[model samples]
Target: APLMEIDPRSPVPKYAQLREILLDWIEESRLGVDDAVPSERELGLTYGLSRMTVRQTLDQLVDEGKLYRVPGKGTFVARPKIEMSLRLASFTEDMRARGFEPGSQDLARRVAPASGHLARVLGVAPGDPIHHLERLRTADGEPMAVERSNIPLALAPELDRHSLAGRSLYRLLEQEYNLLLDSGEQTIEAGLCDATDAKHLGLTAGSAVLLLQRRSYANGTCVELAISTYRADRYQLHSTLDARR
Candidate 1:
Protein backbone atom coordinates (compact mmCIF):
# COMPACT_ATOMS: atom_id res chain seq x y z
CA ALA A 1 0.00 0.00 0.00
CA PRO A 2 2.63 2.52 -1.04
CA LEU A 3 -0.13 4.96 -1.93
CA MET A 4 -2.33 4.20 1.07
CA GLU A 5 -4.08 7.39 2.13
CA ILE A 6 -4.95 8.38 5.71
CA ASP A 7 -8.69 8.74 6.50
CA PRO A 8 -8.93 12.07 8.27
CA ARG A 9 -12.61 11.45 9.12
CA SER A 10 -12.13 7.91 10.48
CA PRO A 11 -11.71 9.11 14.12
CA VAL A 12 -8.01 8.11 14.23
CA PRO A 13 -5.44 10.72 15.13
CA LYS A 14 -3.46 12.01 12.17
CA TYR A 15 -0.17 11.24 13.90
CA ALA A 16 -1.17 7.61 14.44
CA GLN A 17 -2.39 7.37 10.85
CA LEU A 18 0.91 8.68 9.56
CA ARG A 19 2.81 6.34 11.91
CA GLU A 20 1.02 3.32 10.52
CA ILE A 21 1.60 4.54 6.96
CA LEU A 22 5.35 4.83 7.56
CA LEU A 23 5.43 1.40 9.19
CA ASP A 24 3.66 -0.07 6.16
CA TRP A 25 6.12 1.61 3.86
CA ILE A 26 9.02 0.05 5.71
CA GLU A 27 7.36 -3.38 5.77
CA GLU A 28 6.63 -3.17 2.05
CA SER A 29 10.31 -2.39 1.29
CA ARG A 30 9.45 1.09 0.10
CA LEU A 31 11.81 2.23 2.84
CA GLY A 32 14.87 0.16 3.68
CA VAL A 33 17.58 0.15 6.28
CA ASP A 34 19.55 3.42 6.26
CA ASP A 35 16.99 4.95 3.88
CA ALA A 36 16.14 8.50 4.93
CA VAL A 37 12.61 9.26 6.04
CA PRO A 38 10.78 12.27 4.71
CA SER A 39 11.39 15.56 6.49
CA GLU A 40 8.78 16.72 9.00
CA ARG A 41 7.62 19.53 6.71
CA GLU A 42 7.33 17.23 3.73
CA LEU A 43 5.55 14.53 5.73
CA GLY A 44 3.10 17.09 7.14
CA LEU A 45 2.34 18.44 3.69
CA THR A 46 1.83 14.96 2.24
CA TYR A 47 -0.36 13.74 5.11
CA GLY A 48 -2.32 17.00 5.62
CA LEU A 49 -0.94 17.22 9.18
CA SER A 50 0.91 19.88 11.16
CA ARG A 51 4.67 19.69 11.39
CA MET A 52 4.37 19.04 15.13
CA THR A 53 2.23 15.94 14.51
CA VAL A 54 4.73 14.59 12.03
CA ARG A 55 7.57 15.16 14.48
CA GLN A 56 5.61 13.36 17.17
CA THR A 57 5.09 10.36 14.92
CA LEU A 58 8.78 10.24 14.06
CA ASP A 59 9.77 10.45 17.71
CA GLN A 60 7.55 7.50 18.54
CA LEU A 61 9.11 5.36 15.81
CA VAL A 62 12.61 6.35 16.88
CA ASP A 63 11.94 5.32 20.47
CA GLU A 64 10.55 2.00 19.24
CA GLY A 65 13.83 1.30 17.39
CA LYS A 66 12.36 1.50 13.91
CA LEU A 67 14.28 4.68 13.03
CA TYR A 68 17.50 6.48 13.96
CA ARG A 69 18.53 10.09 13.72
CA VAL A 70 21.85 11.41 12.49
CA PRO A 71 23.16 14.76 13.74
CA GLY A 72 23.17 17.45 11.04
CA LYS A 73 21.27 15.00 8.84
CA GLY A 74 17.84 13.33 8.86
CA THR A 75 16.14 10.21 10.24
CA PHE A 76 16.63 6.82 8.60
CA VAL A 77 15.20 3.35 8.92
CA ALA A 78 17.08 1.12 11.39
CA ARG A 79 18.11 -2.49 11.11
CA PRO A 80 15.65 -5.05 12.36
CA LYS A 81 16.19 -6.20 15.95
CA ILE A 82 17.11 -9.75 16.91
CA GLU A 83 14.40 -11.51 18.89
CA MET A 84 15.77 -13.43 21.89
CA SER A 85 13.66 -16.12 23.46
CA LEU A 86 13.43 -16.12 27.23
CA ARG A 87 14.86 -19.43 28.44
CA LEU A 88 17.61 -21.04 30.44
CA ALA A 89 20.49 -21.12 27.96
CA SER A 90 24.00 -19.80 27.58
CA PHE A 91 24.81 -16.97 25.18
CA THR A 92 27.01 -19.32 23.20
CA GLU A 93 24.18 -21.85 22.80
CA ASP A 94 21.64 -19.17 21.92
CA MET A 95 23.84 -17.61 19.24
CA ARG A 96 24.68 -21.00 17.76
CA ALA A 97 21.01 -21.89 17.53
CA ARG A 98 20.46 -18.62 15.69
CA GLY A 99 23.23 -19.52 13.20
CA PHE A 100 25.57 -16.80 14.45
CA GLU A 101 29.13 -17.60 15.51
CA PRO A 102 29.42 -16.64 19.16
CA GLY A 103 32.59 -15.34 20.84
CA SER A 104 33.72 -13.45 23.93
CA GLN A 105 36.53 -11.09 24.83
CA ASP A 106 37.81 -11.29 28.39
CA LEU A 107 37.81 -7.89 30.01
CA ALA A 108 38.64 -8.80 33.62
CA ARG A 109 39.06 -12.01 35.60
CA ARG A 110 40.15 -12.27 39.22
CA VAL A 111 39.29 -13.45 42.70
CA ALA A 112 37.62 -10.66 44.62
CA PRO A 113 35.77 -10.16 47.86
CA ALA A 114 32.03 -10.68 47.64
CA SER A 115 29.99 -7.54 48.12
CA GLY A 116 27.17 -7.49 50.66
CA HIS A 117 24.52 -7.66 47.90
CA LEU A 118 26.26 -10.32 45.84
CA ALA A 119 27.02 -12.37 48.97
CA ARG A 120 23.35 -12.48 49.86
CA VAL A 121 22.29 -13.43 46.35
CA LEU A 122 24.90 -16.24 46.15
CA GLY A 123 24.21 -17.37 49.73
CA VAL A 124 27.78 -16.59 50.71
CA ALA A 125 29.04 -14.47 53.55
CA PRO A 126 30.29 -10.95 52.96
CA GLY A 127 34.05 -10.60 52.41
CA ASP A 128 34.18 -14.19 51.16
CA PRO A 129 36.27 -14.96 48.12
CA ILE A 130 34.45 -14.65 44.79
CA HIS A 131 35.54 -15.08 41.22
CA HIS A 132 34.63 -12.00 39.16
CA LEU A 133 34.72 -12.37 35.39
CA GLU A 134 33.82 -9.63 32.96
CA ARG A 135 33.64 -10.11 29.22
CA LEU A 136 32.32 -8.52 26.02
CA ARG A 137 30.15 -11.12 24.29
CA THR A 138 30.05 -11.03 20.50
CA ALA A 139 28.15 -12.64 17.63
CA ASP A 140 29.64 -12.85 14.14
CA GLY A 141 32.43 -10.60 15.45
CA GLU A 142 29.85 -7.90 16.26
CA PRO A 143 29.57 -6.70 19.84
CA MET A 144 26.32 -7.87 21.43
CA ALA A 145 26.48 -7.53 25.19
CA VAL A 146 28.74 -6.82 28.14
CA GLU A 147 28.48 -9.43 30.89
CA ARG A 148 29.83 -9.52 34.42
CA SER A 149 29.66 -12.82 36.27
CA ASN A 150 30.26 -13.59 39.94
CA ILE A 151 30.78 -17.08 41.29
CA PRO A 152 31.71 -18.08 44.80
CA LEU A 153 35.44 -18.74 44.69
CA ALA A 154 35.11 -21.75 46.99
CA LEU A 155 32.87 -23.50 44.43
CA ALA A 156 35.27 -22.99 41.52
CA PRO A 157 38.69 -22.64 43.01
CA GLU A 158 40.49 -23.66 39.84
CA LEU A 159 38.36 -21.49 37.54
CA ASP A 160 41.30 -19.18 36.92
CA ARG A 161 43.34 -21.99 35.40
CA HIS A 162 41.01 -22.21 32.41
CA SER A 163 40.71 -19.72 29.56
CA LEU A 164 37.18 -18.39 29.10
CA ALA A 165 37.63 -16.17 26.06
CA GLY A 166 35.57 -17.54 23.14
CA ARG A 167 33.99 -20.09 25.55
CA SER A 168 30.80 -20.47 27.56
CA LEU A 169 31.15 -19.99 31.30
CA TYR A 170 28.13 -22.21 31.97
CA ARG A 171 29.66 -25.03 29.90
CA LEU A 172 32.92 -24.84 31.79
CA LEU A 173 31.13 -24.87 35.13
CA GLU A 174 29.19 -27.98 34.10
CA GLN A 175 31.88 -29.96 32.24
CA GLU A 176 34.90 -29.13 34.37
CA TYR A 177 33.48 -28.47 37.84
CA ASN A 178 30.33 -30.61 37.54
CA LEU A 179 28.27 -27.72 38.79
CA LEU A 180 25.34 -27.97 36.43
CA LEU A 181 22.92 -25.06 36.51
CA ASP A 182 19.49 -26.62 36.56
CA SER A 183 17.45 -23.46 37.03
CA GLY A 184 17.73 -19.72 37.14
CA GLU A 185 15.80 -16.54 37.96
CA GLN A 186 16.21 -13.56 35.71
CA THR A 187 14.86 -10.03 35.63
CA ILE A 188 15.12 -7.62 32.73
CA GLU A 189 14.63 -3.88 32.48
CA ALA A 190 15.14 -0.97 30.12
CA GLY A 191 18.15 1.25 30.69
CA LEU A 192 20.60 3.64 29.07
CA CYS A 193 24.11 2.50 28.29
CA ASP A 194 26.83 4.05 30.38
CA ALA A 195 30.11 5.41 29.05
CA THR A 196 32.16 2.37 30.04
CA ASP A 197 29.81 -0.26 28.60
CA ALA A 198 28.91 1.86 25.55
CA LYS A 199 32.59 2.02 24.59
CA HIS A 200 32.80 -1.76 24.50
CA LEU A 201 29.42 -2.25 22.78
CA GLY A 202 30.22 0.26 20.00
CA LEU A 203 27.41 2.61 21.02
CA THR A 204 27.32 6.16 22.27
CA ALA A 205 26.68 6.78 25.94
CA GLY A 206 22.99 7.08 26.89
CA SER A 207 21.82 4.75 24.11
CA ALA A 208 18.87 2.47 24.92
CA VAL A 209 19.86 -0.87 26.45
CA LEU A 210 18.42 -3.90 28.16
CA LEU A 211 19.69 -4.73 31.63
CA LEU A 212 19.49 -8.38 32.64
CA GLN A 213 20.15 -9.67 36.13
CA ARG A 214 20.26 -13.44 36.55
CA ARG A 215 20.87 -15.86 39.39
CA SER A 216 21.71 -19.39 38.32
CA TYR A 217 21.24 -22.31 40.66
CA ALA A 218 22.95 -25.69 40.88
CA ASN A 219 21.35 -28.31 43.11
CA GLY A 220 19.13 -25.62 44.66
CA THR A 221 22.14 -23.47 45.58
CA CYS A 222 22.81 -20.24 43.83
CA VAL A 223 26.06 -20.66 41.93
CA GLU A 224 26.22 -17.66 39.63
CA LEU A 225 25.08 -14.06 39.70
CA ALA A 226 25.36 -12.42 36.31
CA ILE A 227 24.51 -8.91 35.15
CA SER A 228 24.44 -8.28 31.42
CA THR A 229 23.75 -5.18 29.36
CA TYR A 230 22.46 -5.71 25.81
CA ARG A 231 21.98 -3.12 23.10
CA ALA A 232 18.26 -2.45 22.74
CA ASP A 233 18.65 -1.70 19.04
CA ARG A 234 19.90 -5.25 18.50
CA TYR A 235 17.77 -7.32 20.90
CA GLN A 236 14.14 -7.86 21.85
CA LEU A 237 13.02 -10.40 24.44
CA HIS A 238 10.26 -12.86 23.58
CA SER A 239 8.08 -15.11 25.70
CA THR A 240 5.24 -17.53 24.98
CA LEU A 241 2.00 -17.15 26.88
CA ASP A 242 -0.85 -19.51 27.71
CA ALA A 243 -4.42 -18.50 28.35
CA ARG A 244 -6.59 -20.02 31.03
CA ARG A 245 -10.32 -20.03 31.69
Candidate 2:
Protein backbone atom coordinates (compact mmCIF):
# COMPACT_ATOMS: atom_id res chain seq x y z
CA ALA A 1 0.00 0.00 0.00
CA PRO A 2 1.11 3.51 -0.68
CA LEU A 3 1.98 5.84 2.18
CA MET A 4 -0.70 8.27 3.36
CA GLU A 5 -0.39 11.72 1.82
CA ILE A 6 0.26 14.68 4.05
CA ASP A 7 -2.92 16.24 5.47
CA PRO A 8 -2.76 19.99 5.10
CA ARG A 9 -5.64 20.56 7.52
CA SER A 10 -4.42 18.10 10.19
CA PRO A 11 -3.49 19.51 13.58
CA VAL A 12 0.10 18.44 13.07
CA PRO A 13 2.43 20.76 11.19
CA LYS A 14 3.25 19.93 7.56
CA TYR A 15 6.89 19.09 8.36
CA ALA A 16 5.87 16.84 11.19
CA GLN A 17 3.27 15.12 9.04
CA LEU A 18 5.77 14.51 6.27
CA ARG A 19 8.34 13.24 8.72
CA GLU A 20 5.88 10.71 10.13
CA ILE A 21 4.87 9.54 6.68
CA LEU A 22 8.50 9.00 5.67
CA LEU A 23 9.23 7.20 8.92
CA ASP A 24 6.22 4.94 8.35
CA TRP A 25 7.49 4.11 4.89
CA ILE A 26 10.86 3.19 6.36
CA GLU A 27 9.17 0.98 8.93
CA GLU A 28 6.81 -0.63 6.41
CA SER A 29 9.49 -1.22 3.74
CA ARG A 30 8.03 1.32 1.36
CA LEU A 31 11.43 2.94 1.73
CA GLY A 32 14.29 0.52 2.28
CA VAL A 33 17.90 1.22 3.28
CA ASP A 34 18.77 1.41 -0.35
CA ASP A 35 19.56 4.79 -1.93
CA ALA A 36 16.04 5.31 -3.13
CA VAL A 37 14.97 8.24 -0.94
CA PRO A 38 14.03 11.05 -3.26
CA SER A 39 15.89 14.34 -3.39
CA GLU A 40 14.90 17.15 -1.01
CA ARG A 41 13.45 19.24 -3.81
CA GLU A 42 11.63 16.24 -5.24
CA LEU A 43 10.16 15.27 -1.90
CA GLY A 44 8.99 18.84 -1.18
CA LEU A 45 7.42 19.11 -4.59
CA THR A 46 5.75 15.71 -4.19
CA TYR A 47 4.24 16.75 -0.84
CA GLY A 48 3.41 20.29 -1.97
CA LEU A 49 5.82 21.82 0.50
CA SER A 50 8.89 24.02 0.41
CA ARG A 51 12.45 22.72 0.31
CA MET A 52 13.08 24.16 3.81
CA THR A 53 10.26 22.04 5.21
CA VAL A 54 11.68 18.87 3.66
CA ARG A 55 15.17 19.73 4.90
CA GLN A 56 13.94 20.24 8.42
CA THR A 57 12.06 16.95 8.32
CA LEU A 58 15.18 15.11 7.21
CA ASP A 59 17.35 16.90 9.74
CA GLN A 60 15.12 15.81 12.60
CA LEU A 61 15.18 12.21 11.44
CA VAL A 62 18.96 12.26 11.18
CA ASP A 63 19.28 13.48 14.75
CA GLU A 64 16.82 10.84 15.95
CA GLY A 65 18.99 8.11 14.36
CA LYS A 66 16.25 7.28 11.86
CA LEU A 67 18.52 8.34 9.01
CA TYR A 68 22.22 8.96 8.22
CA ARG A 69 23.77 11.25 5.69
CA VAL A 70 26.97 11.07 3.71
CA PRO A 71 29.17 14.12 3.31
CA GLY A 72 28.62 14.62 -0.40
CA LYS A 73 26.08 11.88 -0.84
CA GLY A 74 22.42 12.01 0.20
CA THR A 75 20.82 10.59 3.31
CA PHE A 76 19.52 7.01 3.54
CA VAL A 77 17.22 5.16 5.85
CA ALA A 78 18.99 3.80 8.91
CA ARG A 79 18.94 0.07 9.46
CA PRO A 80 16.82 -1.21 12.31
CA LYS A 81 18.65 -1.80 15.58
CA ILE A 82 19.26 -5.37 16.77
CA GLU A 83 18.21 -5.87 20.36
CA MET A 84 20.44 -8.53 21.95
CA SER A 85 20.33 -10.43 25.20
CA LEU A 86 22.71 -9.42 27.96
CA ARG A 87 23.78 -13.01 28.53
CA LEU A 88 27.36 -13.80 27.63
CA ALA A 89 27.70 -15.16 24.11
CA SER A 90 30.16 -14.90 21.28
CA PHE A 91 29.33 -12.36 18.61
CA THR A 92 28.92 -15.11 16.03
CA GLU A 93 26.63 -17.17 18.25
CA ASP A 94 24.56 -14.14 19.21
CA MET A 95 23.99 -13.18 15.61
CA ARG A 96 23.17 -16.73 14.61
CA ALA A 97 20.70 -17.05 17.48
CA ARG A 98 18.95 -14.00 16.05
CA GLY A 99 18.71 -15.72 12.62
CA PHE A 100 21.37 -13.49 11.11
CA GLU A 101 24.46 -14.61 9.25
CA PRO A 102 27.48 -13.68 11.33
CA GLY A 103 30.82 -12.63 9.87
CA SER A 104 34.12 -11.16 11.08
CA GLN A 105 36.81 -9.20 9.33
CA ASP A 106 40.13 -9.18 11.07
CA LEU A 107 41.66 -5.73 11.20
CA ALA A 108 44.73 -6.51 13.29
CA ARG A 109 45.94 -9.55 15.21
CA ARG A 110 49.22 -10.37 16.87
CA VAL A 111 51.00 -11.53 19.99
CA ALA A 112 52.36 -8.70 22.07
CA PRO A 113 53.65 -8.08 25.56
CA ALA A 114 50.97 -7.36 28.14
CA SER A 115 51.59 -3.96 29.71
CA GLY A 116 50.22 -2.28 32.83
CA HIS A 117 46.44 -2.27 32.35
CA LEU A 118 46.46 -5.27 30.02
CA ALA A 119 48.49 -7.28 32.50
CA ARG A 120 46.17 -6.39 35.36
CA VAL A 121 43.04 -7.19 33.39
CA LEU A 122 44.33 -10.57 32.19
CA GLY A 123 45.79 -11.38 35.62
CA VAL A 124 49.20 -11.97 34.14
CA ALA A 125 52.65 -10.63 34.85
CA PRO A 126 53.63 -7.43 33.12
CA GLY A 127 55.50 -8.08 29.87
CA ASP A 128 53.92 -11.53 29.58
CA PRO A 129 52.98 -12.54 26.10
CA ILE A 130 49.41 -11.71 25.08
CA HIS A 131 47.40 -12.41 22.01
CA HIS A 132 45.75 -9.24 20.72
CA LEU A 133 43.07 -9.47 18.09
CA GLU A 134 40.95 -6.77 16.51
CA ARG A 135 38.06 -7.50 14.22
CA LEU A 136 34.89 -5.96 12.91
CA ARG A 137 31.91 -8.23 13.52
CA THR A 138 28.84 -8.06 11.36
CA ALA A 139 25.29 -9.39 11.33
CA ASP A 140 23.63 -10.07 8.00
CA GLY A 141 26.33 -8.18 6.13
CA GLU A 142 25.86 -5.02 8.20
CA PRO A 143 28.67 -3.92 10.49
CA MET A 144 27.73 -4.32 14.13
CA ALA A 145 30.71 -4.11 16.46
CA VAL A 146 34.46 -3.81 16.59
CA GLU A 147 35.87 -6.19 19.19
CA ARG A 148 39.39 -5.86 20.55
CA SER A 149 40.31 -8.88 22.65
CA ASN A 150 43.45 -9.47 24.69
CA ILE A 151 44.24 -12.93 26.05
CA PRO A 152 47.24 -14.27 27.89
CA LEU A 153 49.44 -16.25 25.55
CA ALA A 154 50.15 -18.85 28.24
CA LEU A 155 46.52 -19.95 28.08
CA ALA A 156 46.33 -20.33 24.32
CA PRO A 157 49.85 -21.00 23.15
CA GLU A 158 50.24 -21.08 19.38
CA LEU A 159 46.75 -19.62 19.08
CA ASP A 160 48.08 -17.30 16.43
CA ARG A 161 48.49 -20.32 14.16
CA HIS A 162 44.79 -20.73 13.69
CA SER A 163 42.88 -18.74 11.05
CA LEU A 164 40.25 -16.79 12.99
CA ALA A 165 39.16 -14.86 9.95
CA GLY A 166 35.58 -16.06 10.24
CA ARG A 167 35.65 -18.15 13.40
CA SER A 168 34.33 -17.37 16.86
CA LEU A 169 37.06 -16.60 19.39
CA TYR A 170 35.10 -18.26 22.16
CA ARG A 171 34.53 -21.36 20.10
CA LEU A 172 38.19 -21.53 19.23
CA LEU A 173 39.16 -21.20 22.88
CA GLU A 174 36.77 -23.95 23.88
CA GLN A 175 37.66 -26.44 21.15
CA GLU A 176 41.35 -25.86 20.73
CA TYR A 177 42.59 -24.49 24.05
CA ASN A 178 40.04 -26.05 26.45
CA LEU A 179 39.23 -22.58 27.75
CA LEU A 180 35.64 -22.42 28.90
CA LEU A 181 33.66 -19.19 29.08
CA ASP A 182 32.47 -19.96 32.56
CA SER A 183 31.65 -16.41 33.63
CA GLY A 184 32.03 -12.84 32.49
CA GLU A 185 31.80 -9.35 33.90
CA GLN A 186 30.57 -6.91 31.31
CA THR A 187 29.63 -3.23 31.42
CA ILE A 188 27.69 -1.02 29.10
CA GLU A 189 28.39 2.62 28.28
CA ALA A 190 27.91 5.23 25.57
CA GLY A 191 30.38 7.08 23.38
CA LEU A 192 30.94 8.86 20.10
CA CYS A 193 32.77 7.19 17.26
CA ASP A 194 36.48 7.95 16.81
CA ALA A 195 38.23 8.13 13.48
CA THR A 196 39.34 4.48 13.47
CA ASP A 197 36.03 3.13 14.76
CA ALA A 198 34.04 5.27 12.39
CA LYS A 199 35.91 3.85 9.41
CA HIS A 200 35.55 0.24 10.50
CA LEU A 201 31.90 0.44 11.60
CA GLY A 202 30.76 2.59 8.67
CA LEU A 203 29.69 5.56 10.73
CA THR A 204 30.47 9.23 10.48
CA ALA A 205 32.97 10.56 12.97
CA GLY A 206 31.34 11.51 16.29
CA SER A 207 28.24 9.37 15.68
CA ALA A 208 26.75 8.15 18.93
CA VAL A 209 27.58 4.51 19.76
CA LEU A 210 27.27 1.89 22.46
CA LEU A 211 30.41 0.81 24.32
CA LEU A 212 30.85 -2.54 26.03
CA GLN A 213 33.77 -3.86 28.04
CA ARG A 214 33.99 -7.49 29.10
CA ARG A 215 36.34 -9.55 31.22
CA SER A 216 35.72 -13.25 30.60
CA TYR A 217 36.84 -15.99 32.92
CA ALA A 218 37.61 -19.64 32.30
CA ASN A 219 38.02 -22.28 35.01
CA GLY A 220 38.29 -19.58 37.70
CA THR A 221 40.96 -17.71 35.79
CA CYS A 222 40.75 -14.62 33.64
CA VAL A 223 40.85 -15.62 29.99
CA GLU A 224 40.30 -12.44 28.09
CA LEU A 225 39.47 -8.77 28.37
CA ALA A 226 37.57 -7.52 25.36
CA ILE A 227 36.26 -4.10 24.44
CA SER A 228 33.49 -3.84 21.90
CA THR A 229 31.90 -0.79 20.29
CA TYR A 230 28.55 -1.05 18.53
CA ARG A 231 26.57 1.47 16.59
CA ALA A 232 23.94 2.94 18.91
CA ASP A 233 21.35 2.80 16.18
CA ARG A 234 22.09 -0.84 15.32
CA TYR A 235 22.23 -2.52 18.72
CA GLN A 236 20.19 -2.44 21.92
CA LEU A 237 21.03 -4.37 25.09
CA HIS A 238 18.30 -6.50 26.66
CA SER A 239 18.24 -7.98 30.13
CA THR A 240 15.71 -9.30 32.63
CA LEU A 241 15.77 -9.66 36.40
CA ASP A 242 13.52 -11.92 38.50
CA ALA A 243 13.38 -13.31 42.00
CA ARG A 244 12.60 -16.85 40.96
CA ARG A 245 15.44 -19.23 41.65
Each candidate structure's TM-score, on Cα atoms with residue i matched to residue i, is 0.90, 0.80
Residue 41 lDDT in candidate 2:
86
Error of 1 at 232 (Å): 2.2
Candidate 2 segments exceeding 4 Å error: 1-14, 42-49, 70-75, 140-142, 238-245
lDDT of 1 at 27: 93
lDDT at position 115, candidate 1: 86
Off by over 4 Å in 1: none
Could you give candidate 1's per-residue lDDT for residues 134-213 as a string of tens digits? 99999999999999999999898889999998889999999988999999999999999999999999999999999999
Q: Please, what are the lDDT tens digits per residue for candidate 2 over residues 93-188?
A: 888998999999989999999898889888899999999999999888889889999999999999989888878999999999999899999988
Distance (Å) between predicted and true CA of 23, model 1? 0.7
